[model samples]
Target chain A: MARVVVDVMLKPEILDPQGQAVQRALPRLGFEGISDVRQGKRFELEVDGPVDDAALARIHELAETFLANTVIEDFTVKVEEVAEAAK
Target chain B: MARVVVDVMLKPEILDPQGQAVQRALPRLGFEGISDVRQGKRFELEVDGPVDDAALARIHELAETFLANTVIEDFTVKVEEVAEAAK
Candidate 1:
Protein backbone atom coordinates (compact mmCIF):
# COMPACT_ATOMS: atom_id res chain seq x y z
CA MET A 1 0.00 0.00 0.00
CA ALA A 2 1.00 3.58 -0.48
CA ARG A 3 0.29 6.66 1.53
CA VAL A 4 -0.07 10.06 -0.02
CA VAL A 5 -0.02 13.36 1.84
CA VAL A 6 -1.15 16.57 0.18
CA ASP A 7 -0.78 20.02 1.65
CA VAL A 8 -2.53 23.20 0.48
CA MET A 9 -1.25 26.64 1.39
CA LEU A 10 -2.08 30.21 0.51
CA LYS A 11 0.03 32.09 -1.99
CA PRO A 12 2.63 34.33 -0.42
CA GLU A 13 1.33 37.64 -1.74
CA ILE A 14 -2.30 36.63 -1.34
CA LEU A 15 -3.99 38.23 1.63
CA ASP A 16 -4.79 35.57 4.22
CA PRO A 17 -7.79 36.70 6.20
CA GLN A 18 -8.12 33.31 7.81
CA GLY A 19 -4.56 33.57 9.01
CA GLN A 20 -5.14 37.09 10.23
CA ALA A 21 -8.21 35.97 12.10
CA VAL A 22 -6.33 33.16 13.70
CA GLN A 23 -3.49 35.41 14.69
CA ARG A 24 -5.88 37.86 16.25
CA ALA A 25 -7.37 35.05 18.30
CA LEU A 26 -4.11 33.50 19.43
CA PRO A 27 -3.47 35.82 22.36
CA ARG A 28 -6.42 34.27 24.09
CA LEU A 29 -4.83 30.85 23.75
CA GLY A 30 -1.68 31.88 25.59
CA PHE A 31 0.44 31.15 22.54
CA GLU A 32 2.99 33.94 22.50
CA GLY A 33 5.97 34.37 20.21
CA ILE A 34 3.47 33.62 17.52
CA SER A 35 3.81 36.59 15.27
CA ASP A 36 1.45 35.15 12.70
CA VAL A 37 -0.83 32.23 12.05
CA ARG A 38 -1.76 30.58 8.77
CA GLN A 39 -4.28 27.81 8.40
CA GLY A 40 -3.89 25.07 5.81
CA LYS A 41 -5.44 21.76 4.85
CA ARG A 42 -3.91 18.32 4.89
CA PHE A 43 -5.09 15.11 3.24
CA GLU A 44 -3.82 11.66 4.02
CA LEU A 45 -4.79 8.88 1.62
CA GLU A 46 -3.96 5.21 1.81
CA VAL A 47 -4.14 3.19 -1.38
CA ASP A 48 -4.74 -0.44 -0.64
CA GLY A 49 -3.98 -1.69 -4.15
CA PRO A 50 -0.76 -1.20 -5.99
CA VAL A 51 0.37 2.42 -6.01
CA ASP A 52 3.11 3.16 -8.45
CA ASP A 53 3.87 6.01 -10.77
CA ALA A 54 0.35 5.95 -12.12
CA ALA A 55 -1.13 6.28 -8.67
CA LEU A 56 1.15 9.16 -7.90
CA ALA A 57 0.09 10.86 -11.09
CA ARG A 58 -3.58 10.40 -10.26
CA ILE A 59 -3.06 11.96 -6.85
CA HIS A 60 -1.36 14.92 -8.44
CA GLU A 61 -4.25 15.33 -10.83
CA LEU A 62 -6.71 15.36 -7.94
CA ALA A 63 -4.65 18.00 -6.19
CA GLU A 64 -4.63 20.20 -9.25
CA THR A 65 -8.26 19.68 -10.15
CA PHE A 66 -10.08 19.82 -6.84
CA LEU A 67 -8.03 20.22 -3.71
CA ALA A 68 -6.26 23.45 -4.50
CA ASN A 69 -6.91 26.86 -6.00
CA THR A 70 -3.89 27.53 -8.16
CA VAL A 71 -4.52 31.25 -8.27
CA ILE A 72 -4.75 32.22 -4.59
CA GLU A 73 -3.12 29.07 -3.32
CA ASP A 74 -0.18 26.78 -4.08
CA PHE A 75 0.23 23.18 -3.00
CA THR A 76 2.69 20.36 -2.66
CA VAL A 77 2.32 16.59 -2.98
CA LYS A 78 4.16 14.02 -0.87
CA VAL A 79 3.99 10.24 -1.21
CA GLU A 80 5.46 7.38 0.75
CA GLU A 81 5.19 3.62 1.00
CA VAL A 82 3.17 2.48 3.98
CA ALA A 83 5.50 -0.42 4.57
CA GLU A 84 8.39 1.88 5.32
CA ALA A 85 6.49 3.81 7.99
CA ALA A 86 8.31 3.81 11.29
CA LYS A 87 6.59 1.50 13.68
CA MET B 1 15.77 35.32 -0.69
CA ALA B 2 14.40 31.89 0.05
CA ARG B 3 10.93 30.73 0.93
CA VAL B 4 10.49 27.64 3.04
CA VAL B 5 7.21 25.83 3.37
CA VAL B 6 6.76 23.32 6.15
CA ASP B 7 3.82 20.97 6.50
CA VAL B 8 2.87 18.89 9.50
CA MET B 9 0.48 15.93 9.38
CA LEU B 10 -0.99 13.53 11.87
CA LYS B 11 0.12 9.94 11.92
CA PRO B 12 -2.21 7.63 10.03
CA GLU B 13 -3.22 5.56 13.03
CA ILE B 14 -3.67 8.45 15.38
CA LEU B 15 -7.31 9.01 16.33
CA ASP B 16 -8.05 12.41 14.82
CA PRO B 17 -10.93 13.79 16.82
CA GLN B 18 -10.52 17.28 15.40
CA GLY B 19 -10.65 15.92 11.89
CA GLN B 20 -13.73 13.90 12.68
CA ALA B 21 -15.41 16.96 14.13
CA VAL B 22 -14.58 18.96 11.04
CA GLN B 23 -15.82 16.18 8.80
CA ARG B 24 -19.13 16.21 10.61
CA ALA B 25 -19.32 19.96 10.32
CA LEU B 26 -18.46 20.10 6.62
CA PRO B 27 -21.97 19.18 5.53
CA ARG B 28 -22.92 22.68 6.56
CA LEU B 29 -20.25 24.16 4.31
CA GLY B 30 -21.58 22.44 1.13
CA PHE B 31 -18.33 20.63 0.63
CA GLU B 32 -19.12 17.25 -0.79
CA GLY B 33 -16.73 14.46 -1.82
CA ILE B 34 -14.65 15.24 1.20
CA SER B 35 -14.99 12.18 3.36
CA ASP B 36 -12.41 13.33 5.89
CA VAL B 37 -10.81 16.47 7.19
CA ARG B 38 -7.41 16.58 8.85
CA GLN B 39 -6.17 19.87 10.14
CA GLY B 40 -2.51 20.78 9.81
CA LYS B 41 -0.17 23.75 10.01
CA ARG B 42 1.95 25.47 7.39
CA PHE B 43 4.74 27.98 7.88
CA GLU B 44 6.03 30.32 5.18
CA LEU B 45 9.26 32.12 5.94
CA GLU B 46 11.20 34.44 3.69
CA VAL B 47 14.87 34.84 4.37
CA ASP B 48 16.42 37.85 2.77
CA GLY B 49 20.12 38.04 3.65
CA PRO B 50 21.87 34.86 2.65
CA VAL B 51 20.10 31.51 2.59
CA ASP B 52 22.38 28.61 1.94
CA ASP B 53 22.75 25.04 3.16
CA ALA B 54 23.24 26.32 6.69
CA ALA B 55 19.89 28.11 6.62
CA LEU B 56 18.16 24.97 5.41
CA ALA B 57 19.75 23.06 8.28
CA ARG B 58 18.42 25.58 10.82
CA ILE B 59 14.91 25.31 9.45
CA HIS B 60 15.00 21.52 9.56
CA GLU B 61 16.14 21.57 13.13
CA LEU B 62 13.28 23.91 14.06
CA ALA B 63 10.87 21.44 12.51
CA GLU B 64 12.39 18.69 14.61
CA THR B 65 12.62 20.57 17.88
CA PHE B 66 9.58 22.80 18.31
CA LEU B 67 7.36 23.28 15.28
CA ALA B 68 5.77 19.83 15.33
CA ASN B 69 4.74 17.29 17.88
CA THR B 70 6.86 14.46 16.55
CA VAL B 71 4.91 11.83 18.50
CA ILE B 72 1.59 12.35 16.77
CA GLU B 73 2.80 14.25 13.72
CA ASP B 74 5.44 14.14 11.03
CA PHE B 75 6.55 16.94 8.76
CA THR B 76 8.11 17.76 5.43
CA VAL B 77 10.27 20.74 4.61
CA LYS B 78 10.38 22.33 1.18
CA VAL B 79 12.75 25.11 0.25
CA GLU B 80 12.58 27.36 -2.77
CA GLU B 81 14.39 30.43 -3.95
CA VAL B 82 12.22 33.51 -4.06
CA ALA B 83 14.05 34.83 -7.11
CA GLU B 84 13.12 31.69 -9.03
CA ALA B 85 9.50 31.74 -7.96
CA ALA B 86 7.18 31.98 -10.94
CA LYS B 87 5.66 35.40 -10.98
Candidate 2:
Protein backbone atom coordinates (compact mmCIF):
# COMPACT_ATOMS: atom_id res chain seq x y z
CA MET A 1 0.00 0.00 0.00
CA ALA A 2 1.02 3.58 -0.57
CA ARG A 3 0.48 6.43 1.87
CA VAL A 4 -0.68 9.88 0.88
CA VAL A 5 -0.66 12.94 3.14
CA VAL A 6 -2.84 15.96 2.76
CA ASP A 7 -2.25 19.10 4.81
CA VAL A 8 -4.98 21.71 4.86
CA MET A 9 -4.26 25.15 6.24
CA LEU A 10 -6.08 28.46 6.36
CA LYS A 11 -5.10 31.23 4.03
CA PRO A 12 -2.41 33.57 5.32
CA GLU A 13 -4.83 36.45 5.44
CA ILE A 14 -7.39 34.55 7.46
CA LEU A 15 -7.65 34.78 11.22
CA ASP A 16 -7.36 31.47 13.06
CA PRO A 17 -9.08 31.78 16.41
CA GLN A 18 -8.16 28.29 17.51
CA GLY A 19 -4.50 28.93 16.93
CA GLN A 20 -4.82 32.31 18.59
CA ALA A 21 -6.19 30.68 21.73
CA VAL A 22 -3.20 28.39 21.88
CA GLN A 23 -0.80 31.27 21.32
CA ARG A 24 -2.46 33.25 24.09
CA ALA A 25 -2.29 30.29 26.44
CA LEU A 26 1.39 29.72 25.79
CA PRO A 27 2.63 32.67 27.81
CA ARG A 28 0.65 31.56 30.81
CA LEU A 29 2.14 28.11 30.51
CA GLY A 30 5.68 29.57 30.48
CA PHE A 31 6.35 28.85 26.82
CA GLU A 32 7.33 32.10 25.20
CA GLY A 33 8.93 33.56 22.06
CA ILE A 34 6.33 32.12 19.74
CA SER A 35 4.82 34.94 17.75
CA ASP A 36 2.12 33.07 15.91
CA VAL A 37 0.35 29.74 15.85
CA ARG A 38 -1.81 28.33 13.09
CA GLN A 39 -3.87 25.21 13.50
CA GLY A 40 -4.63 23.02 10.48
CA LYS A 41 -5.73 19.55 9.46
CA ARG A 42 -3.65 16.64 8.33
CA PHE A 43 -5.05 13.55 6.66
CA GLU A 44 -3.22 10.30 6.10
CA LEU A 45 -4.70 8.03 3.48
CA GLU A 46 -3.71 4.43 2.90
CA VAL A 47 -4.08 3.67 -0.78
CA ASP A 48 -4.43 0.11 -1.99
CA GLY A 49 -2.00 0.40 -4.89
CA PRO A 50 0.98 2.25 -6.31
CA VAL A 51 1.01 6.04 -5.94
CA ASP A 52 1.82 7.06 -9.47
CA ASP A 53 1.30 10.46 -11.09
CA ALA A 54 -2.28 9.58 -11.89
CA ALA A 55 -2.93 8.59 -8.31
CA LEU A 56 -1.33 11.80 -7.11
CA ALA A 57 -3.51 13.82 -9.46
CA ARG A 58 -6.59 12.12 -8.12
CA ILE A 59 -5.51 12.75 -4.56
CA HIS A 60 -4.94 16.38 -5.36
CA GLU A 61 -8.43 16.59 -6.74
CA LEU A 62 -9.79 14.99 -3.60
CA ALA A 63 -7.85 17.40 -1.44
CA GLU A 64 -9.15 20.36 -3.36
CA THR A 65 -12.72 19.23 -3.60
CA PHE A 66 -13.42 17.37 -0.40
CA LEU A 67 -10.66 18.01 2.11
CA ALA A 68 -10.38 21.78 2.03
CA ASN A 69 -12.68 24.73 1.56
CA THR A 70 -11.02 26.78 -1.15
CA VAL A 71 -12.81 29.95 -0.09
CA ILE A 72 -10.71 30.19 3.08
CA GLU A 73 -8.24 27.33 3.10
CA ASP A 74 -5.49 25.82 0.96
CA PHE A 75 -4.25 22.27 0.85
CA THR A 76 -1.18 20.36 -0.23
CA VAL A 77 -1.14 16.71 -1.25
CA LYS A 78 1.95 14.52 -1.34
CA VAL A 79 2.88 10.86 -1.32
CA GLU A 80 4.58 9.73 1.84
CA GLU A 81 6.93 6.76 2.17
CA VAL A 82 5.00 3.66 3.13
CA ALA A 83 5.94 1.91 6.33
CA GLU A 84 7.71 -1.44 6.21
CA ALA A 85 4.60 -3.20 7.47
CA ALA A 86 2.58 -1.71 4.63
CA LYS A 87 5.09 -2.65 1.91
CA MET B 1 12.14 33.92 12.61
CA ALA B 2 11.75 30.18 12.41
CA ARG B 3 8.77 27.95 11.77
CA VAL B 4 8.06 24.90 13.87
CA VAL B 5 5.56 22.25 12.91
CA VAL B 6 3.84 20.05 15.45
CA ASP B 7 1.75 17.15 14.25
CA VAL B 8 -0.64 15.54 16.72
CA MET B 9 -2.33 12.27 15.89
CA LEU B 10 -4.57 9.80 17.65
CA LYS B 11 -3.02 6.55 18.82
CA PRO B 12 -3.27 3.73 16.34
CA GLU B 13 -5.62 1.74 18.54
CA ILE B 14 -7.96 4.64 19.19
CA LEU B 15 -11.22 5.05 17.30
CA ASP B 16 -11.34 7.86 14.75
CA PRO B 17 -14.91 8.67 13.85
CA GLN B 18 -13.92 11.72 11.80
CA GLY B 19 -11.56 9.74 9.65
CA GLN B 20 -14.12 6.99 9.24
CA ALA B 21 -16.68 9.52 8.09
CA VAL B 22 -14.27 10.84 5.48
CA GLN B 23 -13.36 7.36 4.29
CA ARG B 24 -17.00 6.43 3.93
CA ALA B 25 -17.76 9.57 1.97
CA LEU B 26 -14.91 9.09 -0.50
CA PRO B 27 -16.51 6.25 -2.44
CA ARG B 28 -19.72 8.20 -2.71
CA LEU B 29 -17.75 11.09 -4.18
CA GLY B 30 -16.26 8.77 -6.84
CA PHE B 31 -12.83 8.54 -5.19
CA GLU B 32 -11.92 4.97 -4.47
CA GLY B 33 -9.04 2.62 -3.65
CA ILE B 34 -8.28 4.19 -0.30
CA SER B 35 -8.44 1.50 2.33
CA ASP B 36 -7.88 3.56 5.44
CA VAL B 37 -7.94 7.17 6.53
CA ARG B 38 -6.56 8.88 9.62
CA GLN B 39 -7.13 12.47 10.57
CA GLY B 40 -4.82 14.59 12.68
CA LYS B 41 -3.92 18.14 13.63
CA ARG B 42 -1.01 20.20 12.37
CA PHE B 43 0.22 23.30 14.13
CA GLU B 44 2.44 25.87 12.51
CA LEU B 45 4.27 27.98 15.05
CA GLU B 46 6.25 31.03 14.16
CA VAL B 47 9.08 31.48 16.61
CA ASP B 48 10.74 34.81 17.07
CA GLY B 49 14.30 33.56 16.79
CA PRO B 50 16.46 30.63 15.80
CA VAL B 51 15.06 27.15 16.38
CA ASP B 52 17.90 25.60 18.33
CA ASP B 53 17.90 22.43 20.40
CA ALA B 54 16.74 24.21 23.53
CA ALA B 55 13.89 25.84 21.65
CA LEU B 56 12.87 22.51 20.21
CA ALA B 57 12.98 20.94 23.66
CA ARG B 58 10.67 23.62 25.01
CA ILE B 59 8.33 23.14 22.06
CA HIS B 60 8.22 19.45 22.77
CA GLU B 61 7.28 20.14 26.35
CA LEU B 62 4.63 22.59 25.24
CA ALA B 63 3.22 20.06 22.83
CA GLU B 64 3.04 17.40 25.49
CA THR B 65 1.56 19.57 28.18
CA PHE B 66 -0.79 21.86 26.28
CA LEU B 67 -1.33 20.87 22.67
CA ALA B 68 -2.16 17.19 22.99
CA ASN B 69 -3.89 14.87 25.34
CA THR B 70 -1.15 12.36 26.07
CA VAL B 71 -3.56 9.65 27.10
CA ILE B 72 -5.04 9.21 23.64
CA GLU B 73 -2.80 11.13 21.25
CA ASP B 74 0.83 11.17 20.06
CA PHE B 75 2.71 14.19 18.85
CA THR B 76 5.85 14.94 16.84
CA VAL B 77 7.62 18.26 16.70
CA LYS B 78 10.01 19.45 14.02
CA VAL B 79 11.54 22.65 12.75
CA GLU B 80 10.31 23.65 9.33
CA GLU B 81 12.01 25.95 6.86
CA VAL B 82 10.78 29.48 7.21
CA ALA B 83 9.28 31.12 4.16
CA GLU B 84 11.18 33.98 2.58
CA ALA B 85 8.46 36.40 3.58
CA ALA B 86 8.76 35.34 7.20
CA LYS B 87 12.52 35.78 7.26
**Best prediction by TM-score:** 2
Model 1 reaches what TM-score against the true structure? 0.53
Give the worst 10-residue stretch by lDDT in candidate 1 chain B: B26-35
DockQ (C-alpha based) per candidate is 0.17, 0.93
* Candidate 1, residue B46: how far the Cα is off, in Å: 1.8
For residue B83, give model 2's deviation from the true position in Å: 6.2
Can you write out model 1's per-residue Cα lDDT over B9-85, one digit (the tens) per residue?
Answer: 77767888866775565445544344555666776655544457776776677667656789998888887545654
- The weakest ten consecutive residues by lDDT in model 1 chain A span A26-35
Off by more than 4 A, model 2: A83-86, B83-87
TM-score of each: 0.53, 0.95
Candidate 2 chain A weakest lDDT stretch, 10 residues: A78-87
CAPRI tier for the interface of model 2: high
Native contact recovery (fnat) for each candidate is 0.19, 0.96
Report residue A38 deviation for candidate 2 (angstroms): 0.3
lDDT of 1 at B73: 88
lDDT per residue, candidate 2, B3-82, as tens digits? Answer: 99999999999999999999999999999999989999999999987788899999999999999999999999988886
